[model samples]
Target: MNLNLRNAVISNVSGNTQAQLEDTIVDAIQSGEEKMLPGLGVLFEVIWQNADRKDKQEMLETLENGLKK
Candidate 1:
């Protein structure tokens, strides 16, 4: 079977409101389950794709800081 994770993830969350998305993200994180990683990665990919250069740099800096901890 040919599975497209990105498309699947996007379709799953497509119609969610801001609050819904926030709840989903928070719940996934608080669960701390490995199964949620792919969805989070897909969400981050969407964020990265839509971000401006400044925002991307800020994200990178945040990632760097996180890695330091």
Candidate 2:
């Protein structure tokens, strides 16, 4: 449930395969059971931390722009 554990699990999932990631996400989402989505924020934080500065800036800008809509 912790971010570190979630990242570790995700990291062990091998390559950055989008399909596999999507499937995992779908499985997590479709559980139809009550559970915390705590890992999402941690995942975002990890992604932000690992992103290039320019990409991080662009992502923030995009998020800001999206919020205005």
TM-score of each: 0.90, 0.56
What TM-score does model 1 achieve against the real structure?
0.90
Give candidate 2 regions above 4 Å deviation.
1-16, 24-36
For candidate 2, write residues 1-69 as lDDT tens digits: 465767776575558588976776677668754452544445566678899999999999999999999
What alpha-carbon RMSD in Å does predicted model 1 have with respect to the real structure? 1.6
Number of clashes in every candidate structure?
0, 0
Lowest lDDT block of 10, candidate 1: 1-10
Candidate 1 lDDT over residue span 1-69, tens digit each: 114888898899999999999998999999999989998999998999999999999999999999999
45: Cα error in model 1, Å:
0.3
Following a full C-alpha superposition, what root-mean-square deviation does model 2 have from the true structure? 3.6
